[model samples]
Target: MSMNTLKRTAQIFLLACCCLTMLVVARSGHKPAPTVDDAAKVTVSNVKFEPRTLTVKAGTTVTWENKEGSHTVTSDTGAFESETLSAGQSFSHKFDKAGRYPYYCTFHGSKGGHDMAGVIVVTK
Candidate 1:
């Protein structure tokens, strides 16, 4: 074949491969998690809250997912509390007001969040 013809064929093959890859990726329905301005996440593992402290805007919903053992998310001032959660369990709370919300695990922390504790600060 002529050199120009060979080059054209190679270009066509590459274009076809690119189109096929795009088609496969699109068909898989893989998409990134949508970003929410008023949502946050905290991971609970190793007997402690991962963030230890979190700051978010008022009206934001915060979710805590337990990854390791059984625990509780109790508020220091009796504002909110959760039942004992085992591995893979989760809890969520919406901070509607702007203030500090201190929490702890009833099984490992005290009312004042002495041990397994965390704090959530909400702002306007």
Candidate 2:
């Protein structure tokens, strides 16, 4: 084939590939999670989390605010975690999957009756 013809063919092929990739991505129907400003708040107070069980949408960001004591939000499956938060401190995480994410305060414990734990229910 002529050089010009080969170059034109390559350009067309590249454009087609780009269009196909965009079509596949659009068909997959994936959306990014919302910003942290739209997050829900959880209150942490003295070895306890108020509203321990929270339900949110798949793209929601959940913010944990320490109202009265120090604590950490550690996920059971290690999906996400936060450093120790003292009074008035806060941490946020975006939930992108639909499942029950159980978390706890590492300093407190995860077993027995005294464990400080919480659950995040993410829905589609």
Candidate 3:
């Protein structure tokens, strides 16, 4: 083959390889790290909190809505508490500090986090 023909073929091959590399990278299922939003919500159904564990940024407010039955969002450390919430009632709390805040339903769980409990992890 002529020198120019060989050079052209090599260039095309390199371009094809670069395109393939980009395609593979796009299909690798790489996801960006999750960003903390200004607020978060959890659902309180019968005998359970929708998300048993949550992570939020310090100063974010979390709201829990009682969707199914009566419950309470009582903190383990007495940092916060809510009245018994019947279906359609809700409670909100602002986590001002970065620490682990565990809570539970008064009727179904205890301070030690028993059957019906959840935890919030606050980050700076």
Candidate 4:
């Protein structure tokens, strides 16, 4: 081959090698974290929990935001609870075990007699 043709061939070969190396490196790289929006979410109008029940890994932090006014995050047994949170207020809970945990709001449960509840299902 002519000197120019040989040099051009070598350059093209180097470019192809570089492109293949980049593809291999990209394929071996770590991926971005999965955006699991299931665990932490907000409640909507009428004191309802959005995705009221969720399944998550143990030790994952779950947050509940009361977008609907005058809501509470009370234990299913009416034990542990949060006071009425107006619009834009929030609450959080963590599940240390694998089971179904249910909760409700006291304010709506007794007066309007409407129960605003949620469940957290934790697993391995």
Ranking by lDDT: 3, 1, 2, 4
Model 4 per-residue lDDT tens digits across residues 3-108 = 9999999999999999999999899888999886545554645767777777888877678787767877777654356767888888777767777777767666
Point out where model 3 deviates above 4 Å. 1-36
Clashes counted in candidate 3 amount to 0
How much is the lDDT of residue 113 in candidate 3? Answer: 74
**Model 3 lDDT-worst window of ten:** 29-38
lDDT by residue (tens digit), candidate 3, 1-124: 9999999999999999999999999998698989858889999986998799999999999999999788999999999999999999999999999999999999999887799999999999
Of 1 and 2, the candidate ahead on TM-score is 1
Predicted candidate 1 versus true structure: per-residue lDDT over 1-124, tens digit per residue: 9999999999999999999999998988788898857888889998889899999999999999999889999999998899999999999999999999999999998877698999999999
- Taken over the whole model, the C-alpha lDDT of each candidate is 0.92, 0.87, 0.93, 0.72
RMSD to the true structure for each prediction, in A, is: 6.7, 12.1, 3.7, 4.4
In terms of lDDT, the poorest run of 10 residues in model 1 is: 29-38
Relative to the unseen true structure, what is the Cα RMSD of model 2?
12.1
Q: Which candidate leads in lDDT?
A: 3
Candidate 1 lDDT at 120 equals 96
Candidate 2 lDDT, tens digit per residue, 34-111?
Answer: 764557989998788778899998999999999977789898888999999988899999999899988999888673
lDDT for residue 102 in candidate 1, whole number 0-100:
96
The TM-score, computed over Cα atoms with residue i paired to residue i, of candidate 2 is 0.65
